[model samples]
Target: MNTSKRLEQALKKLYTAFHHNKLNPECCKQCAVGNILDNTDNWKYLSDSHGALELNYIGKVHQALGRKFNGYTPLELLKIERVFLNACNYKLPLHYKNEKPKNPTDKDVLFNGLNEVVKFLCYLDNISNVMDYTKLFEFENDKPKYKLVFTN
Candidate 1:
C-alpha cells in the first residue's frame, strides 16, 4: 500500500518472526532500532583503550573534561534499552496480553512498525549534533563505574 503501511507490515512481520521463530535476532530490525542497545560498546567502540574498555568516558560533548556522557552512542544505548524493555514485565505484546502469540504465523499485528523506527532514526540524525546521544538512556548505572569518551 503506502510507505507507512509497508513499514508497519515489516514491523509486524519481524515482531511476529521474533515472537515465533522466523528471522534472526539482529537482522529483522528497522534501521537497527536499538534491539540490543545496552552493552553495545563492547563491539561497536572497537578501537584504542576504549573499544571494549571499562565504559569510562564522559564530559563536555566532545572535549569532555572530567567525563560525563561516556558509555556508548545514543543509538547503541537505545538498542540496549529496547532489549531490556522487551524482557520487562510491561513489554508484553497485545496478543500476549489478551490472547497469546504462541502461534505467531499470520497472527501478528502491525501496530507502529518501521514508521516509528524511521521517525526515530530521523530524530536521531536530526539532533545528532546538539545531543550527546548517550544521555538519552536509562542506563541503570547507580554509580556508573566506567566512563565513555566519544572520539568522533
Candidate 2:
C-alpha cells in the first residue's frame, strides 16, 4: 500500500482504539500513527497534554512534522485551538477512581474531535517531509518550545 493509504489505516485504528479506551501505545506499536499517539514512545512529548484531541496534540503534530508557528501572530492559533478543544469537550475532566462525574453533553464531542483530528493528521501526513520546523519558535533557555502555526 501507499504511504497515504497506510497512514489512513493507522489513523482509523487509533480512532477506534481511543473510543474503546484501548489507546495504549503497545497496541499500534508498529504503525506510524501509533508511534505518534504512543505516550510511552515516539511522540511521548504528547503526554504533557490530555487526550489525542487537545491543542497540545496539534502542537505535537506540528513539532513532529518539522513545522513551527508564525511567531508574529497568535490570532490564528487561538482560532484553531478553540475549534479543536470545543470538538473534544476538552474542558471536561476525566473521572478516575470514582471521582465526581461531570454531566454529559448532548453532543458527541469525542467523535467530532476525532473526525477533525484524523482529517488534520491526514493532511499533515501528506506533507510530512517538506515542513520547516525551524520557524516554530524563538528559543528560551535552549529548549525547543513550540509556538504553533495553525494550518488550513
Candidate 3:
C-alpha cells in the first residue's frame, strides 16, 4: 500500500478534478494529464497531436534533458492523455470525424476514463491497481475469504 509521492499526488489531483466537474477529455487543460499537471495545457505541445504517442521537437528536447512536469516526463504525459481519451471511447488523435461519446462531459464517461488512467498510472509505478476490488470477493469453502477494510 506504499504509493510513491508522485502517484499519490497525481491521484489526489485526479480525484479532486473528477468530483469538482473539472475533468474533461476534450479540453487539453482539463484532461487527465492536464489535471495532473495543475490544469496546464502546455503538455499539449509535447505531442504533434492530442493523443499522439510520439514526441515533437520541443518534447524530444525536454525528454533529452530529463525534464519532468509534475513528476511525469513529456512522453509519459502524452501516453496518459491517450489512455484517457481511449478509455472514454474517443477515436485516437481526437478529431471531429473520430467516434466519441454522445456526451463527453457526462459523469459516467469521465469516471470510465479516470479508471483507465489510474490503471495506467499504477502500471507505470509497478503497483497494484488501486481501483480493483475483485480481491475482496475471493471465497473459499463457501465462505468469504477477504474482507474489505477502510483506512484513514
Candidate 4:
C-alpha cells in the first residue's frame, strides 16, 4: 500500500523473472542486493551504460534474446528487457549514501518496503505483456547511437 512495500514487490518479481528467463550478463551483485534491500531500481545502469552499453553490448543482448522468442526481433525483446529491468530498479531508493532522510524512518522501514517489491513481482508474474519497447538506440552517421528507454 505504501512506497516501500511497492518497491519490494517490484524487486521480488524482477528477481523471479530473471531467474525464470534467461538474460545472462554479468551484473553488479552488490547493487542488485542494494536494490532488493533498498527497494530501488538499479537496472538502468545495464541498459544505459553512458553509451558504453550501446557501443559494446546491446547488440549481443538482442541477438541472444531473439533466439528465445519467435516473431520478435532482438530489438523488441531488448525494449522489453530494458523496461522490465528498469521497472525492477525504479524509485525504490531515493537516497544515496551520506544523504539524510527528510523524515525519520523506523528500523522496520526496510522490512515493510520488501512487501511492495513482492507485490510488484506478483503483478509482473501475472502480466502477459512484460514490456512494450526494446530498442533504445538510434543511428548517427551510420554508427550506433544511444537511445534512452523511459516508459515509466
TM per candidate: 0.25, 0.35, 0.95, 0.27
Q: After superposing candidate 3, which stretches have Cα over 4 Å from the reference?
A: none
Any runs in candidate 1 off by more than 4 Å, and if so which?
1-76, 79-111, 127-152
Clashes of each: 23, 3, 0, 22
Candidate 2 — which residues are off by over 4 angstroms? 1-6, 23-86, 91-107, 126-152
Q: Relative to the true structure, how large is the alpha-carbon lDDT of every model?
A: 0.32, 0.41, 0.93, 0.36
Q: lDDT tens digits, residues 32-97, model 3?
A: 998999998998888888898999999999999999999999988989999999999999888889
In terms of lDDT, the poorest run of 10 residues in model 2 is 70-79
| Ordering by lDDT | 3, 2, 4, 1
Worst 10 residues of 1 by lDDT: 44-53
Judging by lDDT against the true structure, name the best candidate: 3
Candidate 3: residue 88 Cα off by (Å): 0.5
| Structure candidate 2, residue pairs in collision | 66-133, 68-136, 69-149
lDDT of 1: 0.32
Q: Sort the predicted structures by TM-score, highest score first.
A: 3, 2, 4, 1
Find the 10 residues in a row with the least total lDDT in model 3: 142-151
